[model samples]
Target: MKYQDSLQQASDKAAQVKLFLQRTNLAAHPINYAVSYEYISGYNSELCHIIEHKLLAKAPLDDFVMAELYIRFLAPANPQQEQLLQEASSMVSRMAAYSDVAAEQLDNYIQQLDSSMLQIKNLGADTPLLNIVNQLQHSTTEFRLSQQQMQQQLLLANQQSHQLRHELEQLKQQRLLDPLTGLYNRLAMQNQLDIWFSEQPGRRIAAIAVDLDHFSRFNLEYGNTIGDVILSKVARKVSSYVQNSGLPVRSGGEEFLILLPDVDLRSASEIAEQVRRGVEKLRFVSSRTKKTLPKVTISLGVSLYQQTENWYQFLGRTAEVLLLAKQRGRNQVANETMLAT
Candidate 1:
């Protein structure tokens, strides 16, 4: 049954990829083919959704965008790579076990030889000295062989361990990244915050909470496909602002969060306003109809972390400020500074 299910999934994915390629009019180039395959496979849902949106809208998948998407999704592990990783891991485990057993046996043999020597010495050199010496020589040869084997195993294990660690780090990075906008995801955001807090308990961590203004209305007017394209573009714009000094996170849906460590509230708010203007200035046009999209805007809420506050409280306060921004008017930055005034 599992085999049958796997076969069905493969068939479906192949069909989807073929359809996508036809729709996009993409040539069967290696990069194009690989990108199409990944999209249909649904391994990277975010990437798939964005590409599907573009294809449906007949948007130009230019070299630059295609290259970015390929680098984001196709740069990670595939089945063949994963299988090889598993095999390498198994080999390392087996080698470690073999090394442990070999060392233990060698130690036991050394102890037995020591006992034999002690017995001989206690017996005033009359307790079958020839046999004891012969036994000792044989044990010494076996022990040397065991030591050589153990050393070889240790060398191989070290090499494999290094390779495995590299692969694992790549996997970790891939997992932490958001497939849609090529920004860090929520998990990565939290992990980064924890690291910053641990390093400096009183670090000035500021957050910007971003929400698309009337996203539902936009999606309704332009359809979900166009909506996704807008979201991706907006996220990219937002990410560009803080890429150098902070973490840009696609918190969820059409919302984003930017974490700026060692930044004051004023700096964070300025960054948030920059992101807002960047998003506001974007003009999207459908490649199919050449129809210009409605102007998009985002509401931003910025807040600084309080020493006495927890992460949730800090986040909630930012969220509250964002709500105020939306309530006051969209496409504006709201912060504690504004609230105090």
Candidate 2:
């Protein structure tokens, strides 16, 4: 404890000597740095104990701490320990080069350490070993400041990561949401459809294509503003029917695509009929109507997937059949038809 206190207040050399004083204490704790020292042939556990626990030893104790410390700084071969090799080597070299006896040998150790780095790319980027490097980069000549630099870098990295994640979440919201109706836009629709397709196939998948009969005249006569009102009403009314039904997407102006999972042709037709009846019965207020204006009506084309059909082909066939429903009359639901192969 006294030696640790002295080392805490002392210079790097004094701290290093204090480290030797606590050598045997180090043996009790796993050597965080021992693996690297072992690569170059050095372990000062018992010697460390002798220095720290000298009062407890039996006979004349051998001081392996200074010797192993010297070996740690001076040994030439280290292949496995790459992350701390440079900093550990540099710190050890600093200690050894000051010693008159090891000054010439320290140069050879550094040369070998430098050569080892050539085969390895920046491995330090992976571990939190930046503390040691940052210490050297920002440290005063006298103090070992690796741990301090590590703390500053850690906080900065965490803050940057949080900001980046927030930005990414916002971008994802923009990409996945429809700005006008607050529904999922087309891109998001396709993404979800793909995910659904990959998972359990929709128990009963039905695609219905709907077109507003005489919709063009509404835009032309009522003006785009009134037409927008009518469209919003239509979207809301259709969405209401989808309790557990698949999503309803605005495929295009005056047209919508409804995906109903686990619903077959007969059931899908019933749902479409419900939508038609709902729209037919509602009084649409348009063009200065003190009285309730004319009710809007829509034609729907429903298509059910056969075991072999994909969503793309199913949707295409549904649209074609929907055109047929328009030809018969604008206000009716067409029955499900098999996709022509």
Estimate, for each residue in 39-138, the C-alpha lDDT of model 2 and write its tens digit. Answer: 2222446334433333332211222333333333334442233334445545544443344334335445545545544333366453445555445434
- Residues 1-341, model 1: lDDT tens digits: 21233767878877887887787676767787778777666667878777665554443564445655676556656446767766766776666577667667766867787687667666676557867776887877787787777767776776676677667667768867878777787557767878888999888988999999999899997899888888998988988888566998877567888999898888888888888889989999998799998899999999898988666566767777888899897889999777766
Highest-TM-score candidate: 1
Per-prediction TM-score to the true structure, in the order listed: 0.54, 0.48
Instruction: Extract clashing residue pairs from model 2.
Output: 23-48, 24-48, 24-49, 204-262
Among all windows of 10 consecutive residues in model 1, the one with the lowest summed lDDT is 55-64
At residue 22, give the lDDT of candidate 1: 80
What candidate 1 gets wrong by more than 4 Å, as runs, is 1-167
